[model samples]
Target chain A: MSTSTEKEMWVTKLRKGWQKNLPVEKLLPDTQPAYVASWIYLFGVATLASLGLIIATGLWLSFEGASWYHGSNVGHFVNSLHFWSVQFFFVFMVVHLWGKFWMAAWRGRRMLTWITGALAFVGSIATAFTGYLVQSNFDSQWISYEAKDGFNSVGIGSRFTVTNFGQMLLLHVAFLPVIIGIITLIHVLLVRAKGVVPPIDAFNKELGERK
Target chain B: MGIFDHFMNLRAVYIHLGWFQISITNLIVVLGMLVLFGLALFLPFPGNKKKGQK
Candidate 1:
């Protein structure tokens, strides 16, 4: 029953609310706290860089088709890049997770940030699993046969059949990537919004060492 | 024509201990990450000294 003018006002209100919550300065800060100068902060960026390479190589593979990579020399090279990128991605991501956990990065009411980052990690793992299934090789066939029992035991095999090459490929290249990308975006946004957590000593001193 | 030709075609080396076994490549990569993480934790990062000076 709302009028057109009232509906338009709601859009304006939404826009203003969004900007208020995430202003440009906070979203893209030029300067960070001096504690961020530590080498520990590099792992997060390293993880991000590996993810970028992964997406680039994955996109190229998708363009050429999954089966094409099996026989072509250039395709093999690109496929190798894709595989190595996953290795690097997992290495950096696990290190980043360790760094954040040691620092208790969820402090200062940043639980959502921690949750989103963890979700991104889990989603990335599933995406990588599907990538293995779609490799279109004897290894993939062996993996699929091995994994099918586990999926079937969980009663999700019919919906997400590991034996279905088409389903696994689409999940690897399209579905899970989108989910992981969204979760990663939210994680980054939350980090920017909340600012990096302070060092333990600094935080303890600020709180009068109550704990 | 790829730069990693030699690296890619190397023989797969494995270490076996009783029933446990792991490829040398995986062992090296894991060990390398551990070393890198250790270095990152202890190494002095540049630019922190001048952080608040100006």
Candidate 2:
């Protein structure tokens, strides 16, 4: 018999919370609404795929070390792949954002989803900036030289230290990625929980009639 | 790999319009993205038919 003062275990409470907020069916639905058949929806998945590739290539580069990537031909190829993956990620993410904006994806109490996505974009920019700062190339040195003044003007240069390769490397490889990952995860979970926003035409008869 | 080297070594071509300027590579990439976005809007997605139809 449990005492009246007995407190629930934190693990049990956390499990219950997850179950309440995100059930298995909601988290992994087999079917989507008919309106999900648009090609614009594909860009979000493309962005995810590119992000996966970027992480994979980045991991490979990290394992290979700076000397390998800087000196070896295979390392250069891997580095190139990482770079291209980033390019694709940005393109796909931007296209997805634009498509969602045009469709008014924030409708139906999904403002938090939109906010998370916007935050993820901002976080990605920081991540990319740090990445450029850590490249150890002439371009990276030039970029850092130009960027230091901007950071100093904002009174963050003393702390952020754009000129410090080690600090920038840690931020790029570790900190910013984690922040972006958290934001992206939240955005995706919100999408799953709230369901994709229906087309604007679903509400407006005149818009529906135009199609 | 040699082909990649050749491509990488190729000089970037730039377009100039008054004060505006951009590399051909950047221009192609941007134009390609726009075309893809347009096509995505217009293309007929498979299985998008009415529920009663095949």
Candidate 3:
């Protein structure tokens, strides 16, 4: 339905948009400001690494059945790795969140970055909660049984009943992880587009660090 | 909070009054962080208070 020139023009326009918003130099920066050299910035990378570990280990656990995790030693090791990564992911994410909050990292119209990061944190928590429910053990049973009442009290028991193992497993293995991945990618892209926020002192003398 | 096993051991503030059963642990941690962050932006640097007093 479109002419060739018009189609090419649209493609060129999109390319220009990407270049202006997130040039390759900023997208893959070789250097950052000196002020970024602190323990806080490191937590972001650590958190991301922990997330990667969790997903990698989760894939293995999902592939092998109950016999492998409980029967085979390697499966047990991988299962442990996944569990520990979930713990570390939360730990690192919270530390990073605290650091950013202290720095007001959302300054200079970076609110979307902050918002996406917060949403991803929440999605990760939901994913972890489902992971515990999908364990297929006594612990899972107890948690799932206990969780039913809470869901019913809130009147969403019918749609998202944790007592249903099949539904929970499907959601844990697929749906939630996809949501978390997409949101995290958006958060990272927003950070790249916005660049890191400068310190308050760098902005003004009197306003100083108050900002 | 005791109903949720993992959270049971977390030393969370719990309230059970009639139909309302809530744990303030999550609330406190989230709000506490925000409050501390807000305070950091103002205090330890002679900033503003009640306008007439400052």
Candidate 4:
């Protein structure tokens, strides 16, 4: 009987703490309306969607064994999907980056968002490089040979071998994904924390009126 | 040995239809580009936001 009472008391305390922590009303207070300017904001969404497709197709390719992909018709189609996904991914990502740059979207209290995004971009490029190396084709061979000299000159060559299939595949498929994923998560959190940056003209107007 | 034989066969076929294979690859790439262009038309691109709404 005593143990049952103790358990009930503990459960009550835990429930109270969880309720206090959630305080959804406090978190979702009314703020400035979200600016959904035309369809341009969709570029970020499109890039994310392309990344989703890439991950799905990449999983499929991995399951089939990388070697099986080059010879079989289905494998070739999957390879095409992966290639096209990368191409679209880069195109949308570039547009998203340029869009953020021109808007000076780093303004307000969201500098962390901007910085995290920049880091993610760097991570994505590294991931792409590893991907190129893992292709195991003439392109991969050529890029590996050419890139080795450049990497060697920078002293990072000792850490990452462009010619090593095992290392490159692991980096491309596992390690870089984790890094980029973490950066993306942090970036989204910062964006939600600060909300969207206001329009530049509004900023200019506020400054002008103050003057 | 199994994978090597498959690749050798693929190479043999590709060698015989060299130009055709290349053209098909180019066509696929072009189709991919076209798909991207179509998406660009529908998707938000970031610069079209209104100027003064903060």
Candidate 1 residue spans exceeding 4 A from truth = A1-10, B1-11, B49-54
- Model 4 DockQ reads 0.10
TM-score of each: 0.89, 0.88, 0.75, 0.68
Residues A1-211, candidate 3: write the lDDT tens digits.
3467555577778888999999999999976665554556667888899999999998888889644687777887898898878876877788789889888999999999999999999999889999899888888999999999999998889799899998988999889999999999999999988988998578586565454
Which whole-number lDDT from 0 to 100 does residue A134 have in model 3?
82
Residue A204 in model 1: lDDT: 72
| Model 1 chain A weakest 10-residue run by lDDT | A1-10
User: Local distance difference test, per candidate?
Assistant: 0.88, 0.86, 0.81, 0.74
TM-score, B chain alone, candidates in order: 0.69, 0.74, 0.40, 0.41
As a whole number from 0 to 100, the lDDT of residue A105 in candidate 2 is 96
Where does model 4 exceed 4 Å of error?
Answer: A1-34, A203-211, B1-54
Better candidate by lDDT, 1 or 4: 1
RMSD of 2: 3.5
lDDT of 1 by residue, A90-171 (tens): 9998888988999999988999999999999988989999999999888899999999999999899979999999889888
Task: Output DockQ, candidate 1.
Answer: 0.51
The best candidate by DockQ is 2
- Native contact recovery (fnat) for each candidate is 0.45, 0.48, 0.00, 0.14
Error of 2 at B52 (Å): 7.6
What would the per-residue lDDT of candidate 2 be over residues A1-211, giving only the tens digit for each residue? 3346888778878888899878989999977877898899999989989988988898898887755777788888898898889988988898899899999999999999999999988889899888888778887999999999999998999899999988998888888888988988999999998898987778577445754
Candidate 1's displacement at residue B29, Å, is: 2.0
Give the TM-score comparing model 1 with the true structure, all chains together. 0.89
Can you tell me the CAPRI class of model 4? Answer: incorrect
Docking class of 2: medium
